[model samples]
Target: MSTASPHLQGSQSVATGPKSHPRLEIRNIHRYFDGRAVVDDVSLQIQAGQVTCLLGPSGCGKSTTLRMIAGVEMQDSGEIYVDGKLICDTMFRVPPERREIGLMFQDFALFPHLSVADNVAFGLKGSKDEKRLRVEELLQKVSLTRFIDDYPHQLSGGEQQRVALARALAPRPRIMLMDEPFSGLDNRLRDGIRDETLTLLKEEDTAVLLVTHEPEEAMRMADEIALMRGGKIVQQGAPYNVYTRPSDKASVAFFSDINVLKSQVNGALADTPFGQFLAPGIADRTDVDIVFRPQHVRIDFDRAGKGPLPTATDGVPARAVVKRARYLGHESLVEFQMDYDGSVLKVTVPRVFLPEVGRVMWLTVPRNRCFVFPA
Candidate 1:
């Protein structure tokens, strides 16, 4: 509950990424169904050879938006471009088969009767030997060349997924759209296949727009993530920036443990329950919310006679009771109740800082380490 004295410095830098430009663009896309906007003015671009994940809760328009791009579902009004060529507009709508876009649905969509080679060749239009060559090459790329003659039922879930991907890539489409590509497999297989799939996509030089509801999956796989909420994109950025420096309260607390402290901005200092935090006028407003990660809070044992200020720090004091203590091998999470506002807060500390249960400790948080946004 005690606020750490402010000491750390903060840095601001421009958002930067690879120099590649986007290859697929969805401009002012709007899709409506059953008298509601399933996709509301959603627009995003995916660069070639990079994975762009559309992440959100269920019913957040991610799948619908992807389906719209694939021509599986028609948008009420919008434009879809593939490699800078207009494919969908109000006047003309391209059929899914003619869009030159590969689709990997949630079901994997492998035909039960077709062998791996036959399934991959289903997308190709060529002589028998040419289709066979393409299928065999893709099979090797996905590490499934040995399963060429095997039926879909004979393969493991991961193998089937690899086959599905190979089939999608057979025609060498301009873009690939994947809907929860690894959802059905067990955790272990899912992790392995996720890595393998990404490697295959990179090797194939395929631009992909993947849709998933899992944050961990998005963080691990995506070069950039576009987070959706209520049929709109709430935020989109690289994984680290989206997770650490979120723009709003909804985004900050969506998938992380955040301590939202009420603070008043005054020139360089913001007063919170913990202490007077040093905050530059980043928000450029008098009233704003300061968000701090529990992991950034530094806690140390308070000895009876060590520091000059016995129980107070920088004219601010924290009275807290150690409510809970948990050790998880690499680190420990400590929880306490702040006396100032009766708020429960937690701090993740390295294993070396493990304090005993019911122990009283003082904590300090450098203001610059926290982020501020409008409440």
Candidate 2:
């Protein structure tokens, strides 16, 4: 098997809609189980034809939030709006079927006895001619027109997911809620399916709120990402913004492997093995973590115990001995034992670079890439 590249936005480009009126708006939503807040004060907005992903780890309340929006679970507090009209709140409620919202679950949930066309047309309310026309159109859009009469069991996992998508869209819903809809598909098929599904949703002019625990999935499918943790949004932004300008050290580590150096703040600077880091907004004498991703760490040969000249971008080099190296197909991960404190640091290089375990090298982390946070 071959290694896959990271998923990014624009794998399937489509026309973007104006944000004059959000198709779906969730305001300060909260849900509790046994006095513990499971979905706490979550708020987001998704414009028509836009995809926003609620990204977090498992049990972080992403699915629960989606369920509340779908009307399967009611929020203890907060409001849900569609097209700027209040649809759900503590005092008022709207049934799931009446909300004009479509949902696609991870399992697809297709009826075993129903044909593809019938499944798509199941909830549709129209004349026989209208229902058939809508189902046929969706089938064509999903490129499953030839299997219109096939049952769910006869289709592959990816095909079943497409059929599920068609069914969710057949009613021309104003909003779509998807909960890890592509997780069941094989990894090789996931990227292609996500691109195709996103294209279809955009063309249909539906606002999409997708829930996924995978950061790569969020980056691939979301026009915007709401990074959730412990039932609250920690950060929300475009994939690039969230990935590059993280709010904290944990945020930086969430996207990829991180190398951390523990240090103490004296005055306004934190001294680490690599170099001194500007620790603004932090109190004096406080401990801080100097965080940088592996890719930002540059490794060079140790020539006569001296290394590359220090610059504004690349900080002063620190001596380290290679402990272990592993090739991860597309990239290589090397672990180094820092000579400063005998601590281990991991670095990821775009290309393969493996040296003897005991070899000594100089490592310098780019100053711009390091994020200083309170430890």
Candidate 3:
């Protein structure tokens, strides 16, 4: 939903920029409950007009980190800053409302009794006319001007979410913290609403910290992704870098299905049924896990009961019998039983290609596509 700038009115100057100070910054954040750490030493910086997503599975402390930044929950140890000014510490703190931050949760927490306009203008600080103008401007920006007088109960789920977004942006908060804000909507509705929400946030130029378990959501909305697990951020970077160059097998598996080959390191190399992977710097006798995604596997048809010749890229060809094949909508998944040890490997091809069970094929993994890690 592209619209004119709502933050500017006639002579009022619109603040658009990467401000000198970060809009929000958390340093060495840690939160604990009952002697157990839920958020352990997490830190991130979000500049003005940028979106940073806290991405991970449920119970990975993403929500806790967002809550701490929102001033609803204080970090047991660490400092929270806004505009380079300290807003909260273990003892000192600002209240949630005074933090100049907005929050949108999964439930769309709209006031059912209040009209849409009133709900949007609830937190806005100005004269009556100014508040009404701000509400109208936001409603129009979100394409909900026609329903301004209706109550929350009368609006659809997507409309209610739009209202919530309008409310959050009406106050022009410096930073917005969202916890799975679109999870309640259907898949189709979620995508449209997410795009609209992102547009509004960009127009308003407020930093956003979104918490979600879905990897696709983070990839769509985040300028930077912070992947969390077990109460710590294991990886943080652009979505492409995080997806293509993962720090560990779990990081790779988080984005897609992976095939793992477990082996013991002997003389800095781990030998597997497929081939040997160079595990440099690994201690002798240490267990290592060689991992690759299904798409990285190349399949060759067995002709005359023979396989393709070996090459440097695909070091060795491992012959396997087709165990099962499934034709997905856009691609096909084929599982194979390796001849060396009968271990199973999965490969995905672009279009429909189905082979009967017990048919033999050669599976070769490109060395560059494989990630070697300690098991």
Candidate 4:
């Protein structure tokens, strides 16, 4: 996916950010049903002209948050702000028509009975000539000008998605909210539609908030990601930052795979089965868990004289026999069993450096790279 549009400045651009207000804020939003809290005290902010992705598993309240922002569902207690204006509040429920927001759904919610042009013009509130012009402009913007007269049933999935997007944009709403816009298409079509949708949204300078569960999808499309769990936002930040420096174990596991090492706290030195490792500080507690990515663990099969030693500042002595090695095009994923650890660690290395299956190797952990947190 392409980077954020050049028009999207940093987060501090409230006074000078894109066409909308400094930001779109969802503050302390709560929603419940059947006496169960589906969305509990969640909040997020979307910058103008940047995609803020709401990512979580199913039933995590992501769709409910989108619906509340679109005025389709009422919030139990929070407020929705657009360009700094209060559009949603518990006391004053604004009708969907008056929200001045654009909504694109996963099903391509189009009118089968209406032609493409008429379907887009359905949301427009203007004279016949003005509505016709708006529809024509949007159709051209979405590259569906040739299919303008085709009925929804005759159009392809991508074409239908484009039509839905065109209809959402016909009113020129200040903000746009999309719920899984590419959920129904095949992989090839989904990728194309995603790129096309993003391009059009950028050209129009529309502020967007996309809800999705696919990690790669969110990483590719979002300028920032808000990871939700248990009815609230557990963490939110730039994709790289959130992926590399997660605040908690749950947040870390949510984005990527990791290996946790058990360490014994002894002042500044943490002793482990692999080797004696030192860190910045340690709690008085005797037990701690350290997490690190597979790429960070350097593998050594050849050592000078004393065999491979755990000489790394915080390295561990992991005696593992290579169990399996799968060669990918550019890299190979090597899985091995570490002595009696009861867990296998998979190391990803360049395909050019392949090791025999029965050979043993030393596993080293860098002191500063390991992430330590409460178990």
RMSD of every candidate to native, in Å, equals 4.4, 5.3, 8.5, 5.7
- lDDT per residue for candidate 4 within 49-139, as digits (tens), equals 7788999988899999999988889999988887788888988776888877899888988988999999999968879999999999989
On a 0 to 1 TM-score scale, where does candidate 4 land against the true structure? 0.86
Question: Per TM-score, what order, best first?
Answer: 2, 3, 1, 4
- Over 4 Å off, model 3: 1-19
* Poorest lDDT segment (10 consecutive residues) of candidate 3: 1-10
lDDT of 2 by residue, 1-375 (tens): 111111112233333466466889999999999999999999998888889999988999999999999999999999999989999999999999999999999999999999998999999998999999999999999999999999999999999999999999999999999999998999999999999999999999899999998899999888998999999998888887788767777678788888888888898788877778887667889878888788879999999989888876776899999999999999999999999999999989989888989999999987767777788
Please estimate how well model 4 matches the true structure, expressed as its whole-model Cα lDDT: 0.77
> What are the runs in model 2 whose C-alpha is more than 4 Å off?
1-19
Candidate 1 achieves a global lDDT of 0.79
lDDT of 1 at 251: 75
Report lDDT (CA) for all predictions: 0.79, 0.88, 0.88, 0.77
RMSD of 2: 5.3
TM-score, per-candidate, Cα-based: 0.86, 0.95, 0.92, 0.86
Best by lDDT: 2
- What 10-residue stretch in candidate 2 is worst by lDDT? 1-10
Task: Give the clashing pairs for model 1.
Answer: 4-364, 4-365
Task: Output the worst ten-in-a-row residue range by lDDT, candidate 4.
Answer: 1-10
**Alpha carbon lDDT at 201, candidate 1:** 85
* Model 3: per-residue Cα lDDT at residue 191: 92
Model 3, span 1-375: residue lDDT tens: 111112111222123354487889899999999999999999998888888889999999999999899887889999999999999998899889899999999998998889999999997888999999999999999999999999999999999999999998888899999999999998889999999999989889899999999999999998888999999999888877677667888888999999988888898778876667777777889877888899989999998888888886787888899999999999999999999887889899999989999998998988877877788
